[model samples]
Target: MAYAPQEVVDVVRMAACLSLNLGTPDAQRVTSMVSAGQEANLRGIPVVLDPVGYGATPFRKHLCSQVLRNVRITVIKGNVGEISQLADAGGQVRGVDSMPGQIIPLAAAAAYARALGAVVAITGATDVVTDGRRAFAVDNGHVYLSQITGTGCTASTAIACFLGAEHLSPTLSPASAPAPCPAPATAAPSDPCSSLSPDPDTGTDPSAEPVPDQIVLQPHAIPPATPDTPSTAGPNPSPLGATCVTAPIPSAAASSKPAGDHEPPPYLTAVVAALAYYGACAEEGAE
Candidate 1:
């Protein structure tokens, strides 16, 4: 969100996390977004990529691949199909809803978590969370909540806000309001190296013909004229890879960074928020 810093400060700043929810089947576009997000993360922010309607298109499947390969997310929150699609584990999807998967078993989910190196949060009749080695299920939340289009993305970000806070605690506790996360670590060398893979739906070569809905973000490009505005530039959001949008919790150290690139990571805050949300919901009890 570089077009106007203030705008980013207004929209993204208030935001606890950055959610990449692909509305289309553009496999390649998804790839670009994942890379862009990691760039934000390097800056200390946390990113949450929500893959909707996986198994809906060959392009969508490929997009999942590109996303999985690029970002180091704190949490991967989705229904069964979305999570299943992520690990190259096959499953059926109904529009954006999950039908089921061969990996529906708890062991399968744990295996997927190990392979992907992420915490898998599957929201089904019950919700399951695992970092490959550990798993927890959350039975809170209303079914009506799932009807909304961006609810999952929003939920993921809400969790980010908590993690990004100074104590990595949710602001919901008025008595325990926390300060922001530390500023980004821009002094670190440029991270041109990312795990985000190219279009497997298209071809192995970077210059290969792109399949329909297949696109990837380049390693060097400028992002966000502002958070409200969308970026059209392709690839390379920053030549140095120091501008990841996924932010960490804002700490006193954030103030030490130089001007123009000192944005604190919202990611850590979001996670704190997520934990807080669950706590609140648990207090209220299930409907």
Candidate 2:
């Protein structure tokens, strides 16, 4: 469906997370994606980017770079070749598929994550997830997944869902909750000094008015999804089964900064969980 840029922004305002996929990008779609992503960032909604076939063409690379530069991405999920190419670490790609036998170092992935300020997930036989400082390897998928199309996109969607649930849930701590956007400032007609000239005795300048009270734009409360919610619950059982098992890797001591100086974002755990679940699903489907 074609969405105007304003419509895209409206949709993103109510969304808990936004996912931008570069599978079959066009100029209009790219424009909408960037607009929606900026809106998502303003609302503190998580944004997931799937740079599909990023290394295949100059246009794809440029589009991916555009999104990365314009949006503060929460998670970036792609195959090893795509991630490697994006990180400038090095890998071969034949169209959208990663060439077999290429070895992109895990450290490269970590460094890329640090540089981009987003969690990076590289899917392969042994999936790798990292935030530069900490990393994890998830071994839970089937080889058959490689034969399928759109699996990478689906994985990115899953990560967005998990992040949305965590960030938008009512139970989230107030300190960590996404801050509400402030409404556009308008001249307050009721301001006593708004139209008043500077008084001779009491120096009050109408031009130099005090800041008006800003109206916090509280988004409409979205009810938590339940089993009864049709949108959240599919009409039929999903062919891809759901399961998750993750093993955390020890943090690399590469940073000169002291440990615990900065805690990893909560979305890091969400990305790991999503990948583990997605890989397990693939395993079950292949079985």
Candidate 3:
């Protein structure tokens, strides 16, 4: 599905973060989301699962559970009551929103995360993100933001904006993910740039993954891909898509050059900053 038209996939990948006002997706539709999620993981896009009103009804809870179990969710955002329900707190919920006076509990948040095997983010006057044992409190938001509808979804979407929306590698895992982007993500420990984040002992958000040092280059190296036959490009970049790359050079030349002792070409200085610096120093800018 990700290999489909660029617009569709980009929207689909960012749908988790974007203010996608999708109605309660049915089981079959949610299953498609799961498929898209796994593809997003393989393609290295961030997936955010929102259990909008999980505990409010058996249907919501069951559907959210299925999505959590299957889809690759980078963060799960919900109000206190909603999150509590997912955690099985059985808090009283008036409609989908948490009832007024419902207190957010750290234990419930933690339990929900453990049960779903993913990071949990609960939104209230203050937002709490937890991977069961580890927790982070993110306070960078305007109170007015919540006054509007779809604001929570917007925040989730904001997280994805730093991805393909900005600039980055096509193969690396997402960085600065507010919490764990659980499941189906293809990012690995071998990724040199992978953030060692969500500190288990203390709550510290490894700041958002730094955009790959923009190195001017040609048609970027497509992500590692399996093809019916080896082709030059895999899935094309979607508008809102963010890329997770392996060891990336600051600039394109460094990436293309060999690290061994071989001397760089004279023209190599023309494009590569490292080689250019060396060449200028070696020859004092002589023609």
The CA root-mean-square deviation of candidate 2, after full C-alpha superposition on the true structure, stands at 19.5
**What TM-score fits each model?**
0.52, 0.68, 0.49
Error of 2 at 79 (Å): 0.6
Candidate 2: tens digits of C-alpha lDDT, residues 209-231: 33233211111111211324223
Best by lDDT: 2
Question: Per-residue lDDT for 1-287 in model 3, tens only?
Answer: 23233344465545433222123557666666666666666665555556666576777667767766765555566677777666666565555566765654454555455555555656654455555434433332344544555555544444344323322332335574344332112334223212222222233223322212221111122222122323222253111012212122234353332233122211111112211122222223232
- Residue-pair clash count for candidate 3: 11
Residue-by-residue lDDT tens digits, candidate 1, 184-227: 22211122111112322223432122211211211111222233
Measured on C-alpha atoms, candidate 1 has an lDDT of 0.46
**Model 1 per-residue lDDT at 162:** 43
Q: What lDDT would each prediction earn against the true structure?
A: 0.46, 0.64, 0.43
In model 1, the runs with Cα more than 4 Å from the true position are: 1-16, 25-32, 100-103, 146-150, 166-287
Which lDDT value does model 3 have at 35?
63
**Clashes per candidate, residues 3 or more apart or on different chains:** 55, 0, 11
Cα displacement (angstroms), candidate 2, residue 164, comes to: 0.9
Q: Which predicted model would earn the best TM-score?
A: 2
